[model samples]
Target chain A: MAATKDPRPCSIADALALVGEKYSLLVLREVCLGNGRFDQLVRNIGAPRDILATRLRRLVDAGILTKRAYSERPQRFEYRPTQAGLELEPVLMTLMAWGDRHLRKDDDRPMVIEHVCGNELAPVVTCRACGDPVRHEDLAAHPQVSGWTVSGPSAA
Target chain B: MAATKDPRPCSIADALALVGEKYSLLVLREVCLGNGRFDQLVRNIGAPRDILATRLRRLVDAGILTKRAYSERPQRFEYRPTQAGLELEPVLMTLMAWGDRHLRKDDDRPMVIEHVCGNELAPVVTCRACGDPVRHEDLAAHPQVSGWTVSGPSAA
Candidate 1:
């Protein structure tokens, strides 16, 4: 059987299609971190100004962010996370935790998130129903597409 | 501080620097899903062959994946996740869950993950110290870099 010609219609794929562009999530990082002004994003993300503008526009169009006027004289605007964008914070946290574990020394971590629980935040993905930390081996995927399986496209 | 001339060094930024390319995470997605061969990846990810090859090489070089000879006669190789790569599964799961909640109808989700605990997996990010599901408002960011705050660079 040939592998399916199309990528599986997946929400992960969909999410990536929206936010996977270079510098896009970094833009989210800046905004979510409360640095949302254009100049601040340009400085904090190191994305070229034009590219940063484009990303901000795309995010706003996708409803992940909103722009609000923050200055009156020059009409300066700032970005803010919409609900959808705020919810992605965990994804960013997990990614950061991974990088902290594998790429940085504990003392070299660039920033730390302190959860309201009073400890430095280490994000863990858990099963909502079971409250157990998720592990790769303990999960089984069921492709909801017509002709695909967890392994690949089903034989025609 | 004039917006601090440098982007705040961040592990999230470091992680994004490594896997922030267009198809890198999707490549990881396929490998994690057990479709690790070249043809399988090509079919499953729909990335151009050459681009996919570059991504595979980069992933292997980054130690997120390993290339192992799977067939001797034709010298075929398959990719497998390293420990670091498996740790990224939660990020993917969370991204998928976000997309499912925001972008797709419940019945329209293209896949479901079944946790070993006999429930459909709904990945939730929780605080490791407190076991509470993380919320945007409940977290605080502390920028470790000098002259930076959650809002922006401090005035020098």
Candidate 2:
């Protein structure tokens, strides 16, 4: 990791602050898949119970999820995704796609996605303006809102 | 996180296994931003020296980055992204967008992306099948390849 003299804000850092922990997004993933109960999350996520609780509270605080009562007698709560949480579907999808492409030995994708019509699907990221598949070559990143200086290995 | 009774493959888990740690992606971010030297990465990422070294080696082993001899006098090397590393541009872009939208205070976005035409851009993830933004409602995730039971909050 390189040190930057400029203390400009970095979005990657902010996003990581939200979900970069090893098990944070996994918790959210479980919630996204509708496993909102604490016990269910504990079993599936394989994270410590306390850590799971903390991540849940953090996600709620981050406005990505909301907690609602599912049972009154036991005071059980079910976590649900807010609009912001739902927006993370793409990030999860892309992560899954990358994993499917690079990591798995067998076609044993843990979760298989499909449409009601029984059509298997893969999602792609594209440009809103051009409707073209977004690629590294097609875009350049500026560290700040302005002043586009070329950096990275490609520049070499 | 939900426990899966069925031991199917999970791409997200696989991907997370590679880069889900708190500082792993940060290291990658610094590298992606062209801060490949050890001292540069350490300063910018604020990660421990040993951890950064370990991550750089792991990234090299993962085929995401390659090490090249940059200087012979002192035996210095530069880390460069391979094809796989470059493919992560979209992921970084999306992360930046999320941060800018939800995390930043004064719009100090770490990375600003622009098209060749100088049009500021936000990458959108969509499905290739329908040319539509793949939202949670548009699809369903099955625990297994054969079984297609809908199990998510949106199902209700």
Top model number, DockQ = 1
Error of 1 at A78 (Å): 1.0
Candidate 2 docks at the CAPRI level of: medium
Per-residue lDDT of A44-70 in model 1, one digit per residue for the tens?
888899988888899999999999887
User: Which candidate should be chosen as best, given lDDT against the real structure?
Assistant: 1
Write down the lDDT of every candidate, Cα atoms only.
Answer: 0.87, 0.74
Q: Write the per-residue lDDT of candidate 2 for residues A1-156, one digit (tens) a residue.
A: 342454335777777888887677877787788877888777677778899889989999999989999889979898888887878878888888888877866676767787544467676778778778877677766666343233644565
**Residue A117 in candidate 1 has what lDDT?**
88
lDDT of 2: 0.74
Lowest lDDT sum, 10 consecutive residues, model 2 chain A, at A145-154
The per-candidate count of clashes, in order, stands at 2, 16
Instruction: Report the backbone clash tally of model 1.
Output: 2
Candidate 2 lDDT, B51-139, residue by residue in tens:
88888888889988888878999999778777777777677777777777877677666567786556787778877677777777777
Best by TM-score: 1
